[model samples]
Target: MKILVFMKQVPDTAAPISVKDNQVDASKIDKYAASPYDEYALEQALQIKDKAADTKITLVTLGPARVREMIMQGLAMGADDAVIIKHEPAKHGELVEPNDLDGLAVANVLAAAAKKIGYDLIYTGTKGVDDDQGWVGIAMGELLGLPLVAGARSTEVSGGTARVLRDVEGGKEKLEVSLPALITSSQATEPRYPTLKGIMGAKRKPVLEWDIASLGVAADALASRVERVALDMPPGRQAGRLLLGEPNDQVQELVRLLREQAKVI
Candidate 1:
């Protein structure tokens, strides 16, 4: 069996960020990490590889050169090989944030690469932490005309088919799908940390690099459909007010504040 996992590099959630000239100043971020959801996707692929014979897991990512490290990290986590759909900002002579490519563009790029590299199953994160955009996997499935199970919590593959369990409104729903499908993993399982041996082996793993031109994707397909007009941080928290008085007096004061200041009443 051949499996493919789509991964991405994301700034740490706690990393400090600011906006300047309508673009986020990511230089202030001290660290970058793989997307949490994608890690789960990788873990799911690795689990399947462990059980199935002759299974090879390949990691795929789309980003600038800086993201190669993130892809290597996935290799260390046990993916057999990797492919980077590379984008070079210097070549374009402009700074392009990851978000510059909308979900459609990202899906387009991944679909093109997946077509180039055939696979029986494809795995991806349910959503990206940075943008919280959960559209890529489903969109890619649509573009490829394949069955997709988005936000799958658990999956079992056997005899040319897969059974997936996913969260619903108040419970879980199970689905049975044929081979050659896409599954977007979320809360599947805890991601495994790279062992020393795995880390050392990752250095020798092959990572093929491809560009939009090589993929035969039109330039227009890579264009961002949405433009950012402005960016700003949420308002800071306000200090809490203490209502110190008799119970009745406190209630009256609280009601007054809620009615007049908060204006909820």
Candidate 2:
């Protein structure tokens, strides 16, 4: 079996972010890591490889050259090889920023690459950390004409079918999808870290780099559908207030506050 996992590099959520001139000041950011949710997707693929020794796992990422750091991490985690869809402005015209592209555009590019590199199944994070727009995986499935299981917390493949468990309104729903399907991974097991041996081996793994044009994706398809007006930090939180008095008075005051100032009631 062959599995293709779509991963991305995103700014570390813990890092302090600042906005300048209506855009995120990239200079203020320092740390970057694999999107947390994508790690979950990679973990799922690695677990499958653990069971099926013959399975081949490949990591696919679309971004600038810096994304190689994230790719190396995935390779260290057990992906057999990797493909980097290089988004260089100088080489690929003006459409090079992966983060700037809308979900549909990004999906189109990835779907095209997926077609070039065959796969029996595809895995992706439910949403990216930076945008939190959970559209790429679903959009890819639509573009590829493949069945998709979204928010899959657990999955098992057998006899050309994949059984997926996903979260529903209050509980979980189990679904069985045929092969050549896409699954958007949610929370399942904790993602594993690369060990010393795995890290060393990752240095030698094969990495195939390709430009968007090589995938035959039209330049117009990469156009942004949405426009960003500005970026700003959220307002700071307010301090809490105390209602001091007898128990009954405090309860009454709390009710009054809820009904008046808080207005929650």
Candidate 3:
């Protein structure tokens, strides 16, 4: 079986963040190994590969050269190979610069890259923590003509089909799908860390590169522009007042303020 995992590089959460010129100042951010949500997708892929050692699991990502670091992490976690769509770095942001791709455009590029791979199953993070747009997998599935299952907590593959369990707002639901479907994983599932040997082995695994021209996508497909923007931090919230007094006094004062002064009850 051939499986594909879509991955992405994001600003490390621990790094100090600031909004400048309406773009994230990521130059000084200390990059983490991989995204937490995508880690669940990787873990699910590894688990699938573990059961069937013959399974070929590959990864795909989009970003600057530093993004390959994330692909390497997936390799270390036991994905057999990888493909990285390298985006040119810019002073502001990729969205503000060339290949002006939003989350949907990025998804378009990914769909183009995976179009010919003929993967039996595709795995992805339910949502990117950085963007939180939750469009990539759905967009790819739409472009590729495959069924989509989001918030997947567990999955099973058999006879060229998949049985998935997805976590909804209040509970969970099950879906049985044929092969060649897309599934987005969430924290309802657990991801595995790489073993030392797996890390060393990943160094020699294949890492392929692709671009717009090779992927046969038009400049228009990635054509998107910027508009209204905000370049500063939101005003910090003021501390709340602490009502300290006799129980009855505090209640009376609170009620009066809510009803007469604040006009909110």
lDDT of 3: 0.79
lDDT of 3 by residue, 1-265 (tens): 9888898777777877666567666655666456677888888877777788889998988877877778877888789899988787554543333223676778788988888566888988887877667888888898889988887888878788888888777988899989889998885445667789989998899898887678877777776543536656679998988889999999998998899978997
Worst 10 residues of 3 by lDDT: 91-100
| Number of the candidate with higher lDDT, 1 or 3 | 1
lDDT: worst 10-residue window of model 1: 89-98
Give the true-structure RMSD of model 1. 2.5
lDDT of 2 at 149: 92
Best by lDDT: 2
TM agreement with the true structure for every prediction: 0.91, 0.91, 0.88
Q: Against the unseen true structure, what C-alpha lDDT does each candidate score? A: 0.87, 0.89, 0.79
**Residue-level error in angstroms, candidate 1, position 112:** 0.6
Residue range 1-265, candidate 2, lDDT tens digits? 9999999888899877776656566656788888988999999988888888999999999988899999998998889999999984332232223367889999999999999999999999999998788999999999999999999988888979999988899998999999999999987799998988999999899999999889998888888788878768898998889889899999999999999988999
TM-score of 1: 0.91
Candidate 1, 76-125: lDDT as tens digits: 88999999988754322233454678889889999999999999999999
131: Cα error in model 1, Å? 1.3
User: If candidate 3 were superposed on the true structure by all CA atoms, what would the RMSD be?
Assistant: 3.0
